[model samples]
Target: MKNLRDEFPLIAKNKFAYLDSSATSQQPKCVLKAVDDYYKKSHANPHRGTYCLSVEATNAYDFSRQKVADFLNAHFEEIVFTKNATEALNLVAFSYGSFLKKGDHVLLSLMEHHSMIVPWQRACKTHGATLDYIKLNNNFELDLDDFEKQLRKKPKIVGISSVSNVLGTKNNVKQIIEMAHSVGAKVLVDISQSIAHEKFDVEKMDADFVVFSGHKMYAPMGVGVLFAKEELLEAMPPFLLGGDMIEYVYEQETTFAPLPQKFEAGTQNVGGAVGLKTAINFLEEIGFDKIKEIETELTKYARAELKKLKFVECYFTSNAKNHENVISFNLKGIHPHDVASILDSKGVFVRAGNHCAQPLLRSLGLNSTCRLSLSLYNTKQDIDKLVEALKYAYEMFFKTK
Candidate 1:
């Protein structure tokens, strides 16, 4: 497990404990090398040229797509690459969302990230469709009763995150998908936070659409995955036009490319695709069970230690086992940014403020929070350092006052 930290070059060079893996993970050496090597040897505009370089680039990109497809138990054509998860969500919100009619409803939980929330909000607003949220219970978890009630409204589609970005609260996504389907609703599950911790089988999950970001799962930025059922992809129109996404173009009419290419409008990120492939290979080498073990242990230990801090108020569910990688807390009277700054001075890094989930925080009666997220590479010592730095921040604040 100690060897995992060494695999990430940036982690190796930095003495600080990088507890912000949820924002974006540090790239492993293999992923970086794969990206660098692809640019040096195989960079080309795929699907646009007949040259050998372009052919090689095309093969690499296709292979990466196939790899991701296999990883998700999805069809190769069902896998569309986007700039990031935000774009992938936007694609869905723009494309399939176009089918929405007046009075059609879209349901999401209160815990959704802004990427998931804003897109649906825009889509519903555009289509004269109603958008509403499932309420959260006292446990800081999504209320199943509220979810069922929302389903009663016959939402046309439902968007949900498998894990909360701020709270690390894992939802019963499989059950939700099943229920949503029974209501004749399509379901989109954002696995951006959960993908790094476990293996995924989209078919088994019965999800209509799934999205994730490469950067969240140890690959470089600029690559994201959108896995929709082939039927869904076929039914939805393309979100963007131009470049490789088109099959034919005339002065007055144009036909779009099929499957995955239809959503990928521009020159795709071949280098990032190369890196994403290597990142998957690297993670498989480490194995998901080991990754979960490391993160789960750290989470439990940190929860126990944090519980001892009276001045620190945690903003998560009471069930310690309910949360996974993210630990949202704040010094009782200090601003989150100030706490972050103090922690930074002591070589402990974390995310401050609303974590792009302002609505979720407001729902929790918090304006902001300091969030420390865990990764497989994180150790108990890292948690210890965070604890020390937090104590330092608390003391520095009240003692000075």
Candidate 2:
């Protein structure tokens, strides 16, 4: 795979295997330069400014927004910028979720991150609504039959991930969305894990809401995109109340701004958005087809190698084609933290712990597991480092036995 490994300065300098891209990707130099240029050349508050610099800043910010909109094939006013996918999910939970009344149900899959689960839990509790989950099958993938049955609950809304952050299992979201909509439920799909590896056409996905983090896709942290239909953005109330989101402030009464600006309260991350645009540009230049080709090959290789280590029990599906981005497994009779620490000493990085999906871990009867999440930038050498580190960890823990 002809990857842009050298474009990332940190990746070039470090002798480290950064297998944690699902958490957040390393920023390319182009993306970093875009962010730097935004701050240095175009630094001002956007949307309400009249001065030259403010106008320039506003232009840059809007351009970034439009870039994202075009990428998603969404309306110009439909994309709202937030700090991260966490905030974007919270926005939907509080605002669009406000439509929920007593006895209504909210459904999500078992494999969602806390960012997706907790907000709906609280929202359901506050609104006197019911919350349910679509169970996972033996393969650790979402159970389609169970999901269809859950739709019998006639949920008001459903939140699901396009891909599980922990398991790397891709959901049949288009079919799931269809089922949810057949039962008159609005679907919100979190693509935070899959965004970097796969292509998305939100209009085609036919979901009411989509949330993703720019950092997870290759931009700097502090920028996320909330893609909703313009009508839905109009229907929902703003999540945060602050300066820039206002239309007019009266002593006793205030009016809010329209569509995108209404949800973006406080000072926006203009620099981060600029970085996001450049990051998207970088990926588009590579083409997602090639990105997926490289990652799938690497993941299959990692899985096959990990599988050979009989001392380790993989939490992944037996079908290597199913789980692509992440590989979660544990060394037999060793704490995941200990294994992760050993891998760290060898400059082989991977994540340990519940990965913010405590429910998913509990379902698997595991407190935690070491996770190797793949990105297009990752190499077979990175996989080799991880495999060798696992071998060392295994020997350290159970050599006497």
Candidate 3:
């Protein structure tokens, strides 16, 4: 634990219990230095410049793309870097919508981030298509019976999250993909929450598009990934048009660049890509499976401890054997915001809100809940402080009465 704590110097100095890794992860020194090194040694526009520094920078960025591909076990040609997961989902929604005709349907799950929902909503509006929702059962799992009913509507696209950011429920993505494929719907998975914990192979999942954010996986902001099938990339039109994405621009006609670059218009995030590469390397060195194991144990402990508090009304299942590294719950007769305020006083940090899944929160009949999300960097001591803080919060907010 000391070694792990020593690896993250800021965690010790700040003394801040950071359980909000779902929003963003703390970058290690290696990842921080990678961004700085790029600025000092290789700062040039990628793929366009012919100078030595330019070529070096281009190779570094391209290599980063390959690293991302390898990380997800997909082809380099299939990975398209975007500003964030929101932009990635928009790329698919807009480009794919261009081919959609009026009255076409797009099916989405109730357990989606706003990024996954809003873009498709706009896409359906723009193309005069219809958007339908697959229902969720009492336990917050996707209702297959309801999904089968919606399949009859002949949806052109099916969008879902691999893991719920609020509920911490891991969806049956492989089965979801197979079912959607049987109905001839292209499946898009929002892997922003799952990628950091589990191994994901696009081929095995059979996803048409898989999107995730770098910030969630110990990388810096302003960079994310959108992986698509090769034929689909070739078929869909570019969402944005600019310098790097075009082959030639004339008064009459223009040809777009191939596969990835066609989608990534403009100069691109060169330094962010370098940082992302470093971040991925960090995860690989630590071993994602090991990270998962540590977090799984901690999450289980936290959930079990939380359930024991008389004031806590757990929203998600306490059976930590099933959930991911997230736990959301409410204190009896106390608002979630107040609970967060008390925890804040004790140097504990947790999210208290719908967590960008407002629709799902509403479905759960909750405006908000205190969320404790774990990462590989988190330890038992962090959870101990949180549990202690929760006990204090309950006593102050409810037990006093």
Candidate 4:
């Protein structure tokens, strides 16, 4: 397989050693040009006009929605586009929060991004429900035993991350879903970090909802997918009521559009969705399996090389069998921001701070962890640059002292 580095033109530019794919991925020319082409030639408001340009824009937008549905193995009607994963999650929280009662409970893990945790917390507060957090084991994997204990609590919604953005620990979502369902709790997966690395089948996972951002998959920012079971979407009320989501508005009563559009409200991110579809097509052409393999190799190389540094304390299981293509580690006697600054001086990019996963960071008893997240465009050579930068950083920070 020709790796993504060979396929993507941006890598050739040596713009920066980008290891922050967890933050957002570099867009391929195919996706970028798709957005440009849409604006340059076929720009118009979708579903609101009868002209040829409008029809073209509507078709392009609908095609992108269908592509996202197919990518998740979900029905097109179940997919709703939001500004980003945060908004996707907020929509669910706003709608479903109404269902909670005084004693109702919402379950989540410490590993979740704030996108997943904060919404539920606010929902619980508004709807009079309690929130429960699943603790991590010594290895930083969700402690199955702790999870089992929490299952007895039988929360109304069990929200979990498909992968930890900070630690790179992949969650056993299928097992978690099955377990949650057995307890009569619905599951919502925060898949922002996992969607690009592996397959996500909503039906197979039996999740009631799954939220993800487009940018993490090399799609444009400001577009995301919110997948809900059709019935759930139907049962939930409209998230935002406005012109498009309404069927008819009278002085007496108003009616709303069906499942997706009800939540979509105003004009959607038509161009972003088109770019997302193009990005998905690009990934499909490269084969997800190949991307996963390349990332796994890169992660393995990173873990092995980073472990050699005497000052480093690596997180995640060193086995590399269960981890994603990310590395989170701390250099002794140096703050993560300091380490990241030195690495940046070498043109190496990495993510620092809590990674919007404050609960997990608190659990680890640290203010922040330096993270290196890999993607298809990364190679072993990227890992080499990282290791070299780390050595220099360590010498400058620790050995000099």
Candidate 5:
């Protein structure tokens, strides 16, 4: 596998083991340069000003949206930029979900991140709707039987994760979407974890809506994407009512702007969007085939090595074959925070917590676990360093016991 670590200035300089790609990916120099170049060359309020700089900014911002649409195989009008995936999901919950009435069921899975869960919970409360969850099987995978049973309840909408943030389980979202659609339920897929690692074609998948974060895919923070079918976007009301989203304003009533703009209510993160476009271009240059190959090899190697440690209690031990570069485990008798601190001392950075999936962790009877997530930039040598750090931590913590 080709090691492209030099492209990331942080990795190149610090040489730290970064195993938290699921949380947020490290930005490459090209993405940083893109953002910097945008600010340096064409920094202005897009879509509002008629000046040359503003026109250039608007054009660049629109081009970024087009680039994202092309990347997802969707129409440009279908993409709406937001602050993050959480905001995108909340947009659907507030706008589209407003149509839901009392007794309407909103089906979700146990594996959703808190970002996906909390918004719907609030939406359901506001709309007088009922929330339902699909259970996980013994393998920590979504129980398709329970999913079908829940679908039989005739849900109004389904919110599911394309990939679980903590478990690293790549769900069969296409199948789930089909099932939901059969019951006339619109499905919202949170692709925050899967967007960078896998191929996602919104049209091909026939997804009603999809949301992902730019930071998770090597772009800067403060830019996210909400992709919905044009018809659905047209039907849903705007989540935020503000300057850019208004077509006309009156003393008593105001008319909203077009499909995407209506949802994008304020001045956007133009530099962030430019960086996201650059990040997408970089991913395209590297290609998913290479990304998958590297991630698969690293995941397999890490899992194999982690399994060798008797003190490590892996969460999804049986279905690790389905894991995509994320490993969540706990050291027997050591708190995850302590484990993380020990690893940090050795310059091996990993996430230690519920990973914002408290419900999933609770289901597994765990309050917290240490997580090691990989990306195209990770290497087996990083895993070796992680293992060595784990051994050191184990000896330091347990030797006296």
Candidate 6:
């Protein structure tokens, strides 16, 4: 109900209908100020210097980690900061996944982003594990029957997305995790798409590992989080071995730091972490109830408006009502890139391409699609602008013939 665009200077000034929250969200003034303030006042190498400024910097960074942990109902020690979700997944693949032996299995879903897929693919190749996929149903949601059937294969690890970045389908990760665990499989959930829009409680879900990027949640880029149980992190070898990650160094051998610091190597994006904390605070201030209410209304309105256009071919099934804020479609006979270009010219920003989930798009018999993703800052008016722009594109490209 609240017009959140005012809080985002770029959105307010440009007045662009930003419908690509799935790609990366616009930052609020508060988040920007938080990053700026950290650089201006608390700029120092955290955990390296004993000076007052360094101590403050370390505290700020540590506090942000704690904030993130609390945000996901996780233990502080369980949080490991990475450059992005890609790095987080790679960390798991290189560290925890290294334990896989010959003939072991790693189960992934059809809708996983490339970030989730590539790492497992490489890991399986390295460890002689077999990479398997859980097929999608007619509704583009994960086929639970196939998932259970795959579990019988006794996978060593199962990786899945909480929400499909391409389809906007909210998978039942909890149920999948339960099923995987029944077969003694450790589950890693990619929360990059769901963390900003939905309620994610790591403890409640009991996920073995969870990864998300700050950029997708109105925070600064260059910061991501990997949440795993402390014991699991302690057991896994450090992904990156370097200066800060070590407890002590010898000519022949080196000892690593405890829990999280063992995984966070080299200098970190301190400002990004501060901004991420601020962004979480901003979301909390708005609250999830209001967030969901706005997104639900926008999604329904957009879906209805899009359906009215005969040329618009929406990929969602009729019974698929849980596509929170993403609509993937193709204007009949219009290339996705062309549709996106036309929308851009009209000051409507949307995403077009495989959305980094080519496998999922391929499953749907599409190479690419024009995606309109919404956020709390987006409104019905924004959807209206998108509809108008799409209609204009259709007219310009198809009706002329």
Candidate 3, position 147, lDDT: 94
For 1-401, candidate 4 gives per-residue lDDT tens digits of: 65457556778678568899999988888888999999999889998999999999999998999999998899989999999999989998989778999999999998898988998999999988999999988987888889899999889899998888999998899999999999999899999998888889898888899999999999999999999999999999888878789888999899998867888889888999999999999988988888787888888888888888888888986446779977799988889999999999998999889899887898889889899999988877787888889889988976666
TM-score of 6: 0.98
- Clashes by residue pair, model 5: none
Candidate 1: which pairs clash? Answer: none
Candidate 6 achieves a global lDDT of 0.91
Q: Give one digit per residue, the lDDT tens place, for model 5 in 259-315.
A: 789899889999999999999999999999988888889988998999999999987
Q: Measured by C-alpha RMSD in angstroms, how accurate is candidate 2?
A: 1.1
Q: TM-scores, in order shown?
A: 0.99, 0.98, 0.96, 0.98, 0.98, 0.98
RMSD of each: 1.0, 1.1, 1.5, 1.2, 1.0, 1.1
Q: List lDDT for all candidates, in order.
A: 0.92, 0.91, 0.88, 0.89, 0.92, 0.91
**Per-residue C-alpha lDDT of model 1 across residues 255-350, encoded as one tens digit per residue:** 988888888888889899888989999888988888888888989998899989999998778887678899899899999999999999999999
Q: How far off is model 4, as Cα RMSD?
A: 1.2
lDDT value for candidate 2?
A: 0.91
- Indicate the residue-level lDDT of 263 in model 5: 92
Question: Which regions in candidate 6 have their CA more than 4 angstroms from the true location?
Answer: none
Off by over 4 Å in 3: 399-401
Residue 141 error, candidate 3, Å? 1.7
